[model samples]
Target: MTTPLVEMLDIDKSFPGVRALSRACFELLPGEVHALMGENGAGKSTLMKILSGVYTRDGGTVKLDGKPVEITSPRQALDAGISIIHQELALMRDLTVAQNIFIGREPRRFGILDEAALNRDARAIFAQMNLKLEPTVRVETLTIAKQQMVEIAKALSYRSRVLIMDEPTAALNDAEIAELFAIINQLKSEGVGIVYISHKMDEIKRISDRVTVMRDGEYVGTVPAADTPIDTIISMMVGRTLSNETAAITDTSRNPVALEVRNLRRGRDIRDVSFELRRGEILGFAGLMGAGRTEVARAIFGADRREGGEIWVGGKRVGISSPQDAVAAGIGYLSEDRKLFGLATGLDVRNNIALASLARFTRAAGVLDDAGMHQAAEKYIRQLSIKTPSDTQEARLLSGGNQQKVVIAKWLLRDCDILIFDEPTRGIDVGAKSEIYRLLNQLAADGKAIIVISSELPEILRLSHRIAVMCEGRLTGILPGGASQEEIMRLATLREPAMEVRHAG
Candidate 1:
C-alpha cells in the first residue's frame, strides 16, 4: 500500500468557552480529494486550521509521509509543502498579479526589487497551471474566478503538495466552478492531495474521492464519496434525516398588500424595479450574482438612497430617506453580510436580540430594564430554537445558524410587518437551513410579508409563493411556485423587457 500523504489522529482543541475539536481524525492520500463535511460549529475548520498552522492543536499526532512532524506556524506549514486558500481571498487588490503572488518572497537584486524576475516567476507558475492571466494586470481588474485562480497559483508557487480549500465555490458561478474543477483535476493528476471543505453536497460527490464527517467537535465517520448516498452523508454530518420535501405552495392571493414598490431605481444597480408583496407571502428574488437583487432590497430598506422610486407601506406612500425611516415604517432588512450589518458580535446574545427594540426596555428615567431585555431574549431564544448556553453568552460564540436566529429574533422583537431576508442560509448547514426554512414559513404564515433574495435556485423554489427573477438590474419575470429551474434560468439571463408583471388577485 502507498503511504498516505497526510494523517491526523486524536486531535483536540479548545477555546475560552468552547471545545472546538475532540478526538477528531482525518486522512488524505496522494492524488486524492478528501472532503471534510460538517455543520458550522462541527470543528471541521478548526481541525484544518491546526493542520495549516494557523492554530496550535491542544493535542494531536500529525504525520506526513508516515513521519510525525510539528507544524507550529504558517511559514513552517508552507515550508512543509502545505497551503491553505481561505474563502475570503487574501490577495492585495491594488498590486499587480505578479506582485501579489510574490509579495513577501520577491526576487531582489542588491536590495532592489527585481520586477522582471518577479513577473517571470509568476508567469512560470501560471503556465504550470495552464491558466492565462497577465502578470502585470492589477488584481482588482480581474473577475473573482481569476482572483481565485491567482490564489491557487500562489499556493502552487510554494510547491505545495497538500492544499486545503475552504468553500472555494461559494462565490463562483457555474462556469467559474467548472473552470476550478478542471484545475483541481490537473492538480490531482500531479500527485497533489487536496482537502476540500464545503457545505455543498453535489460538489462533494462530483469532486471528492472520500468524505469525512464531523459533528459537534468530534469525528463521526468517513466513507467513499462515490459509494455513499448524499442523504446518507447529510445524515452523518447532521445526525438526522432532514426533510427534502419542497414547501407547499400556499395560496396567498387574497392577502392584503403589505408593501409595494413602484419604479424603484438606483444608479445602474437597480432599474425601475416594481413589485408588491402581500401579507402572509414569501416572495423569492432569484438571479445570478450582481443581478441587483440585493440592490433592490437595500433601496427598499433605505440602507441605500434611491435615485427615483415610490414605496408604499399599508397603502400609504412613505418617504424613506434612511434606515431609521424605513424601520419606523415597520420594515426590517436582514443583510446578506449578517456579521457586518446585523449583529454586534462582541455583545451578549440577550443584548443583540434586543438591539432593535431597545426602546421597549427603556424606563422613563432613561435607564434600561435589563430584566425585560433578558425576558424578551429568552422568549425568542426558545421560540427560535437558538442553541446557546444562555442569553448572556457572547453572540460570536454561537454557531452561524444560531447567530442568524439571533438576528431574526431582533427583528421579530421590533414587531416589523415587512421582512427582507437576504441570503438567509448562505453559510448555514443542512440542519440549520431546515430550521431557518421553518421559521421563515412560520413568519409568513403569521402575516408578515417576506422578500427573500437568494443566489440559490432551490432555496427560492423551496420557500417562495411567487418566484421573482432578475437580470442586469431588471425584474425579468415572476413565476408561480414550483416553476422549473429552466424557466427561472431563462429569466435570470434575459435582458429584454420582462413578461407582464402579474399581481395576485
Candidate 2:
C-alpha cells in the first residue's frame, strides 16, 4: 500500500478549563478528498489547527510522506508543504489580489519590489486553477465567492502538498459551490491530498471519498463515504440516532397575532415584505443566504431602518424607531453575530442577563440592587438549563450553546413576548442544538411569539409551525409545517420574473 500523504495519531490539545482534543487520529492519501466530520466543539478544528501549526498539541505524532517532523509555527507548516484555509478568510482586504497572494515573499531585486513579476506569478497561479481573475484587482472589491477563490489560490502558491479547507461552502450559493467543487477535483487530479471539513451532509456524500467522525474530542470512526449513511454518520458524531420525526402538529391558528409587519421596504434588500407571528407559534423565515430573511427580521425588530412599513403589536400599530423602542414594545432580537451584538463577553453571566432590564433592579437612589439581580439571573439560569459554573462566571467562558441561552435569558428577563432568533443554533454542537430546539418549543407553548431565521432547511422544517419563504427580498410563499425540502426550496428560489408573469396575467 502507498504511504498516506498525511497522518495524525493520538493527538491531544487543551486550553484553560477545556480539553479540546483527546486521542484524535486522522489519515489522508494523495488524490483523495478526506472529510473530517463532527459537531461544533467536537475537536475536529482543534486537531486540524495542531496540524496546521495554529495551535501546539500537548501530545501527538504527525507524519508527512513517511517522515516525522515537528511543525512549531504556521511558517514551518507552510514550508513543510501544509496549508490551511480557515472558515474565516484572513486576507488583507485593502491589498490587491496579487499582493495578498505573494505577501511577505514578494520578488525583489536590489531592495526594489518587483511588481511586474508578482502579478505575472499570481496570474499563472489563477490560470492553473482555471480561475478568471485580475491579479491587480483589489481584494475588497471582489465578492465573497471570489475572495474565497483567492484564498485557495494563496494556498496553492505555496505549492502545498496537503490542503485543508474549513466550511468552504457555508456562505456560497449553489453555482458558487459547483465552481468550488470543480477546483477541488482539479487539485485531486494533481495528487494533492485535501482535508475537507463541513457540516453539510449532502456535500460530504457528494465530495468526499471517506468520512471520519469525531465525538467529544475523541475519534469515533472512519468509513467510506459511499457506504456510510448520513444518519449513521450523525449518530456516530452525537452518540445517538437523532429522530427525524417532526414536532407534533399543534393548532395555533386561533391564537391572536402577537406581531405583524405590512409592506416593509428597505432599499433593495427588503421590498413589500409582510408576515405575521401569532402567540404560541414558531414562525420560521427560510431562504438562501442573502435572500433577505435577516433583513426582514431586522426591519421588524427596528435594528435596521425601513423606509416604508407599518408594525402592529397586540392588535395596535406601534412605531419602533430603534432597538430600544422595539424592546419597550415587548420585542427582542437575538442577532446572528452574537459575539458582536448580543452579549457583553467581558461581563459576568448575571450582569449580561440583567443588562436589558437593569431598571427593574435599581433602587430609587439609582443604585444597582445586586441581590435582586442575582436572584433573577439564578432563576432563569436554572429555568433554561444553562450550564455555567456560576452566575458570576464571565459570559465568554461559556460554550457557544450556553452563551446563546444567556442571550435568551436576557430577553426573557426584559418581559418581552415577541422574540426573533436569527441562526439561533449556529456554531453549536448537536447535543446543544437539541436543547435549544426544546427550549424554543417550550417558549412557544408558553404563548410567546417566536420567529426563527435559518439557512438550514431541516431546522426550518422541524421547528416552525409555519414557514415563510423569501426570494430577492419578497415573501414568495408560505408553507405549512413539515413541508418537504423540495417545496421550500422551490419557493426560496422563486424570482421576480415569475411573480411579474403571474401578476401580468
Candidate 3:
C-alpha cells in the first residue's frame, strides 16, 4: 500500500455555540486531487482549517508521510508544506505580482529589497506554470482569474506539498477555468496533493480524483469521482436526493409587462440592450464574462449611470438614476456580492430583513416598532426555511445561503414587483441552490417578475422562462425555454450584430 501524503484522523472542533467538526477524518495521496464537498456549515471548511492550521484541532492526529506532526499555527503549517488559498483571494491589490508572491519572505541583499531577484523568481514560477502574467504588473490590474493564479504561485512559493483550495473557480470564466485546470494538472504531476473544495458538481467530476462527503460536522464517505454519479455524490453530501428538474415553462405572454428597457447604453459595458419582463415570469440573462449581463442589471437598477436608455415600470416610463429611485419605482436588485451591496453584515438578521422597508417599522419621532419588526422577520425566516437559531443572530453569522435569503426577504418586504437577482446562488451549496430555485419559482407563480443573471449555463437553463444571451455588451439573442446549451453558447460567442434583440415568447 502507498503511504498517504496527508492523514487527518478523528478531528474535532467547536466554536462558542456550535460544534464545527466531529470525529471528521480525511486522507490525501501524493499527486492526487481530493475534493472536499459539503453544504455550508457542514464542517468541510472546518476540517480543512484544522489541516491548514488556521484553527487548531481540539482532538485529532495529523500525519505526514506516516509520521505524526503537530501544527499549531499557519506559519507552522506552511513550514510543514501545507498552504490554503481561501475563496476570497488575499493578495494586496497595490502590490506587484512578484511582491504578492513573496510578500513577507522577499529576497533581500545587503539589507535592501532585491527587486531583481524577486521578479526573477516569480518569472520562473510563471514559466513553470506556463502562465504569461507580468511579475511587475500591479495585482489590481489583473483580472480575477489572474489573481487566482497569483495565489497559486504564492502557495508554490512556500514549497507547499499540500494545497487546500476553496471555491477557486467561483469567479472564473470558462477559458480561465481551463487554464487553472491545466495548472492543477502540472502541480499533480509534480507530486503535490490538492484538496479541492467547491459546490460545483461538474467541476468536481472533471478535476477531482476522489470525493469525500461531509454533513453536519461528520464524515459520510469517500468515492471515486470518475465512477460516481453526480446525483449520488449530492445525496451523500446532503443526506437526501435533490430534484434536478428543469423549470416548468409556463405561458406568461398574457401577463402584464412589469419592466421594459429600451436602447439602454452605458459605454462598452452595455450597448443598446433592450428587454421586456412580464409579471409571473423568470427571464434569465446568460453570457460570458465581460458580456455585460451584470452591467445591464446595474444600469437598470440605477447602480450605474446609463449614457442613454428608457426604463418603464408598470406601463409608465420611470426615471431611475439611482438605487433609491429604482426601489421607489418597485425595482430591487440583489447584487452578486451580497455582502458588499445587499446586506449589512454586522447587523442582526431582523434588522437586515427590515432594512429596505425601515419606514414601515419606524414610528413617531423615529422610534422603531420593535414588535412589528420582530414579527415580520420571524415570518419570512420561517417562510423561506432559513436555518437560523433566531432572528437576533447576526447576519455575518449566517451561512451564504441564509445570507442570500435575508436579502431576498428584504426585497420581498419592500414590495418590489420586479426583482433582478445577480448570481443568486454563487457560493451556496447544492441543497441551498434547490431551495433558492423553489423560492424563485414560487415568487414567479405569485406574479412577481424576476430577472436572473448567472454565468453557469445550466442554472440559466434550469430556471429561465426565456433566455436572453449577451455578447460584448450587446444583446445577442433571446431563446425560448428548453433551448439547447449549444444554442445559447452560439449566441453568447457571437460578436457581431447578427440577431435583433427581441423577446421570444
Candidate 4:
C-alpha cells in the first residue's frame, strides 16, 4: 500500500466542561476524498480543528507525508500545506472577489496595489478552473454559492496538499453541488488529499472514498462508503437506529381550523401563499432551500412585513404587525436560526423560561414574583426533562437540544395555541429529535394547531399529518402522511405541476 498523506492517531482534546475528542484516529491518502461523518456535537469539527492547528491536541501524533510533525498555529498549518474552508463563509463583504481571495498577501507594485495585475492573476486562476465569475465583483453582491467557490479558489491558491471542506453544500442547490463535486474530482485527480466533513448522508455516499464515524467524542471506526448503509452510519453516530417511521394522525379534517393564512406575500421570497392549520393537526411545510417556506413563517410571525396577506386566528382575523401582535393573538413562531432569534443565550434557565410571559409572574407594585417564576420554570424543567447543571445555569452553556427545549418552554409559558415550528430539529441530535417529535405530537393531541417547516424530507414524512411542499414561492403539492421519499421528491422538484399532487402511494 502507498504511504498515507496524513495520519492523526489517538487524538485527545477537551474544553472546560466537554471532553470533545478521545482516541480519535483518522487517516487520509492522496487522491482520495475521506468523509468525516457524525452528528452535530459528535467531535468531528473539534477533531478537524485540532488537525488544522486551531486547537492543539493534548495527546496525539500527527504525521505529514509519513513524517511526524507538530502544527501549532493556523500559519504553521498553512505552511505545512493544509487548508480548511469553514462552514460559515468568512469573506469580507466590502472587499472585491480578488481582494477577498488574496486578502493577506496583496499584489504590490512599488509598495502600492496594482489593480490591473490583481485582476489578471485572479482571472487566470478562475479560467484554469473554468469558473466565469468576474474578478472585480464585490463579495457582498455575490450569492452564497459563488462566495463558497471563492473560498475554495483561495484554498487552491495556497497550493494546499490537503483540503478540508465543512458542510460545503449546506447553502447550495443541485446545480451548484454538481459544480463543486466536479471541482473535488479534479482536485482528487491531482493527488491532493481531501477531507470532507458533513452530516448529510447522501452527499457522503455520493462523493466519499472512505467513511469515519464518531459518537460522543469517541471514534467508532472507518469503513468503505459503498458498503455501509445510511441506517448503519446513523446508528454509529447516535448510538441507535434512526426511526424514519411515518406516524398517522387520526382524522384532523373534522377539527376546526385554528389558523388560516390567505394570500401571504413578502417581497420576492414569499408570494401569494396560503395554508390552513386545523386544531390538533400537525401540518408539515416542505420545500427546498430558498423556496420561501421560512419567509412565510417570518411574515406570519411579524418578524418581517408582508406586502399582502390576511391572518385569521380561531375564526377571527387578526393584525400581526409585529411579533408582539402575533404573540398576543396566541401564535408562536420558532425561527429556524434559533441562536439568532429564538432564545436569550446570555440569561439563565429560570430567567429565559419566564422571559416570554414575565407579566404573568408580576406581583404587587410591579415587582416580579420570585416564587411564581420559580414554580413556572421548575414545571417546564421537569416536564421537558431539560438538562442543566441547575435552574440558574446560563442558557448559552446548554447543548443545542437543551437550548431548544428552553425555547419551547418559553412559548408554552405564553400559552399560545397556534405554533409554527421552523426547522425545529435542525442541528439537534437523533435522541433529542425523537423527544421533540413526541412533544409536538402531544401538543397537537391537546388541540394546539401546529405547522412544521423542515428541509429534511424523512422528518416531514415521519411527523406530519399532511405534507405541503413548496417550490419557487408557490404551493407545489399537499400529500397525506406516510408519503414515500420518492413522492415528496417528485412534488419538491415540480416547478410547474399541472395538478395539486401526483397520484402516488
Candidate 5:
C-alpha cells in the first residue's frame, strides 16, 4: 500500500484561554475519505486550521506523504497540496462567480485578467460536476447550494492532495449533497485524500472510510466507519454514552391558533406555503435543505418580504413588513447562522440577555438600569443553567450550547410568544441538545407557539406535536409527532401526491 498522503503527529496548539489541541494525530490515505467528528469547540476546527497553516501548531509535525514539512502559512499549505473549505463562506458577495473562484490567482493574458479564459475554465469544471451555472452570475444572486458548489469548485482548482470540508452539507439539499458525495467519490477514486468534518452521524457512515473522534482538544480514537455503531461514535465524540432523551410530546388538543399564515408566496424560491401554529404546540418543519424551510421561517418572521401573504396573530390581521414589525407582533426569530445573527460575541452575558428588551430595563429618566439588567440576567443564568463563571463572561467565551441558551434567553426576555428556532441545536453537543429539547418542551407546555426547523429527523420526530414536510419550495405534508424518521424523511422528500391532511396509521 502507498504511504498516507498526509499525517499529523502529536500536534499541540493553544490560545489565550484554551489549549485547543493536545498531541492530536490525524492520518489520511491517498485515496480514502477520513471523517473528523467532534462537538463544537472540540478542537476539530483548530486541528484542521493548524493543518492548513491558518493557525501554526505550537508543537508536533505534519508529514506530507511520509515526509515531514514546515507549513507556516496558507500559501505554503496550498503549495503543499492542502486546502480547507470553512463553514462560513469566505466568498465576496458582490463579485461574479468566476472572479470569486479565481480571485487571487486569476489567469492573466498580457498582464490583464483573462476574463474569457476564466469563464471557460469555470464552465468546464462545472460541467464535470454536472452543475449548470453562469460563471458571470453574482454570488449574491445565487442560492446557498449554488454558492457551496462554488466553494467546492474553488477547493478543486488548487489541485489539492488533501481537502478538508467543514460542515459542507449544512446548507445543501439532498440532491446537491448527493452531487457533492459523487464528486467526493470521484476524488477518492482519483487518489485524492479527504477530511470530512460534519456532525451528521448518517453521513459519516455513508461517506467515511475511517472515523476519527476528538474531545476537549485531544484525539480519542480512530475506527472503521462500517464496524463502529452510530451510538458508539456519538458516545466517543461527547465522552459519554448518549441515551436518546427525545421525549414523546403530550397531546395538545383544544389549543387555539396562535399564528396563521396563508398563501405565503415569495418569488420562485418560496412557493405557496401556508400553516397554522397552535398555542402550546411544537410544530416542526422538516425538509431537505433548500426546500424553502428556512425561507418560510424568514418570511413568517418578516426577515424576508413575501410578495403575497396574509398573516393573522390571535385573530387579528397583522402587517409584517419587517423584522421589527414581526417582533412587535410577538414574533421572535433565532437565525440558522448563529454567530452572524444571534449573539454579540464581544458583549457580556448580562448585556446579551438584556439586548432585546433594553427598553424594559430603562429607568423613568430614560437612563439604562444596570441593576435591573444584572438581576434579570442572573435569573435566566440560573433558570437556564448557563455554564458561566460570572454574569460578566463574554458571550464569545462560552460553549456553543451556552451561547445558544443566551440567544434563547434574549427572546424569552422579550416576551415573544411565537418563536422560530432555525437549526437551534446544529453545533450543540448531545448533552446540550437534550437540554435544548427539554427547554423546548417546557416552552410549549407554557403555551408558546414554537416553530422548529431542524435537518435532523430524530429531533423533528421527538419534540414536535406536528411535523410539516417541505420540498421544492412547498409544504408537502403534516404528520403526527409520533412519526418515525423514515416517515418524516419520505414526506420531506416527497413531491407528487401532496398529503396536506394528516393521515392516521
Candidate 6:
C-alpha cells in the first residue's frame, strides 16, 4: 500500500472550559479527497486547525510520508507541505490579487520590491489553475466566489502536498461550485491530497473518496463516500437520523400583513422592489449570488439608504431611516456575517442578547439590571437550545449554529415581530440546520413574520410559504412554496430588458 500523505492520530485539543477535540484521528492519501463530516461543534474544524498549526494539540502524532513531525506554527505547516484555506478568508482586500498572494514572500531584486515579477508569478499560478483572474485587480473588487478562488490559488501556489479547504463553496453559486470542483479534480490528478471540510452532503458524495465522521469531539467512524448513504453519514455525525423532508407550511393568508414595502429603489441593486410579508408567514427570498436578495433585506431593515420606498407595518406607515428606527418599529435583522453585524463577539451571550433591547432591562433608577438581563438570556438560551456553557460565555466561543441562535435570541428578546434572517444556516451543519428550520417554523406559528434570504434553493423551497425570486436587483417573480427548482432557476435568471417596447398608436 502507498504511504499516506498526511496522518493525524489521537489528536486532542481544548479551549477554556471546552474540550474541542479528543482522541480524533484522520488520514489522507495522495491524490485522494478525504471528507471530514461532523455536526457543528463536533471538533472537525478543531482537528483541522491542529493539523494546519492554527492550534497546538494537547496530544497527537502527526505523520507525513511515513515520518513523524511536529508542526507548531502556520509557517511550519506550510514549510512542511501543508496549507489550509480557512472558512473565513484571510486576504488584504485593499491590495491587488498578486500583492495579496505574494504578501510576505514577495520576490525581491536588488533589495527592492519586484512588482512585475509578482504579477507575472500570480498570473502563472492563475493560468495553472485554469482561472481567468487578472493579477492586477484589487481583491475587494472581486465577488465572493472570485475571492474564494483566489484563496484556493494562493494555497496551491505554496506547492504543498496536502491542502485543507473549509467550506470553500459556501459563498459560491452552482456554476462557480462546478468550476471549483474542476480545479479540485485537476489538483487530485497532480497527486495532491485534499482534506475537504463541508456541511454539504451532496458535494461530499460527488467529490470525496472516503469520509471520516466525528461526534462531540471524538472520532466516530470512517466509511467510503460512494458506499455510505448520506443519511447514514448524518446519523453517525449527530447520533440520529435527520429527516430530508421540508417543513410543513401552514396557511397564513388570513393573517394581517406584518410588513409591506412599495416602490423600493436603492441605486441599481434594488430597483422598484416590493413585497408584502404576512404575519405567521415565511417569505423566502431566493436568487443567485449578486441577485440583490440581501440588498433588499438590508434596505427593508434600514441598514442601507433607499432612494425611494414606502414601508408599512401593522397597517401604519413607518419611516425607518436607520437600524434603530427599524428596531423601534418591531423589526430585526440577523445579518449573514454574524460576527460583524449580529453579535458583539467580545461581549458575553447575555449582553449580546440584551443589546438590542437594553432599555427594557434598565431599572427605574436609570441603572442597568444585570439580574434581569441574565434571567432573560437564560430563558431564551433554553428556549432556543443554544448549547452554551452559560449566559456569561463569550459569543465568539460558541459554534456557528450556537452563535446564530444567540443572534436570534437577541432579536426575540427585543420582541421584534418581523425578522429578517439572511443566510441563516450558511455555515452550520445539517443537524443544526434542522433545528433552525424547526425554530423558524415555530416562530411563524407564534405569529412572527419572517423573511429568509438564502442562496440555497432547497432551503428556500423548504421554508418558504411563498418564494420571491430576484434577478439583477429586481423582483423577477414570486412562486408558491411548491415551486420546482427549474422554475425558480428560470425566474432567478430572468434579466430586465434594455428598453420597454410600446405599440405605435
Best by TM-score: 6
Q: Write the per-residue lDDT of candidate 4 for residues 1-505, one digit (tens) a residue.
A: 9899999999998766567788899999999999997765678878888888899998989999899999999889999999999765778999999998888878999999989988888887787667889999999998666888898888888888899998787666677788889989989999999999876778889999999988877889899999999888877878865554445646677789899889898777876777788998898988777788888888998998899989999999999999999999999988775666987889889899898899898888999988888898999999887866567878876666678888889999998999999988765656668778888888988988999998788788788998888888877777878778887777777786425462211
Worst 10 residues of 2 by lDDT: 496-505
Q: Tens digit of lDDT per residue, candidate 2, span 1-505? A: 9899999999998776678889999999999999998876678777888999999889979999978878889999999889998765788999999999999999997889999999999999988877889999999998666888899889989988899998877556677788789989988999999999987888899999999999878999999999988888888888875644445567677899999888899998998987678999998888877789888888888888999989999999999989989998999999886876899999999999999999999998899999999999999999877867689989976766678889989988997899999989765656667778887888888999999998888899899988888888888887778788997888888875244322210
Tell me the TM-score of each prediction against the true structure.
Answer: 0.91, 0.85, 0.95, 0.85, 0.90, 0.95
Report the lDDT tens digits of candidate 6 across residue range 1-505.
9999988899988888888888899999999999998988898888988888888999979999989988889999999989999887788999999988888999999999999999999999988877889999999999878999999889988999999999999888888798889989989999999999999999999999999999999999999999999889988999976766564666666789999899899998998887788988998888889999888888888899999989999989999999999999999999988987998999999999999989988888889999999999999999888878799999988987789989988998888999999999988999989988888888888999999999888899999988888889888887777778997888788895222210000
Instruction: Give lDDT tens digits, candidate 1, residues 1-505.
Output: 9899999999999887778899999999999999998988898888988999999999989999999989999999999999998765788999999998887999999999999999999999888777788999999998666887898888878878999998887666787688789989988999999999988898999999999999999999999999999989998988877866555687777889999999999988898888889999999999887889988999998999999999999999999999999999999999876777999999999999999888889998889999999999999989888877789999977876678889989999998999999988876778888878988888887889999988788899999999988899998888888888998898899996455643432
Task: State residue 296's C-alpha deviation in candidate 4, in Å.
Answer: 1.4
Q: How high is the lDDT of residue 66 in model 6?
A: 82
Q: What's the lDDT for candidate 2? A: 0.86
Q: What is the lDDT of every predicted structure here?
A: 0.89, 0.86, 0.90, 0.83, 0.86, 0.89
Worst 10 residues of 6 by lDDT: 496-505
RMSD of 1: 2.8
Report the number of the highest-lDDT candidate. Answer: 3
Tell me the spans in candidate 2 whose CA falls farther than 4 Å from its real position. 89-102, 106-150, 343-415, 496-505
Q: What is the model-wide C-alpha lDDT for candidate 5?
A: 0.86
Alpha-carbon shift of residue 7 in model 5 (angstroms) = 2.6
Worst 10 residues of 1 by lDDT: 496-505
RMSD in angstroms, all models? 2.8, 3.9, 2.0, 3.7, 2.9, 3.3
- Per-residue CA lDDT of candidate 3, range 282-336, in tens? 9999989889999999999999999998999999999999999999999999998
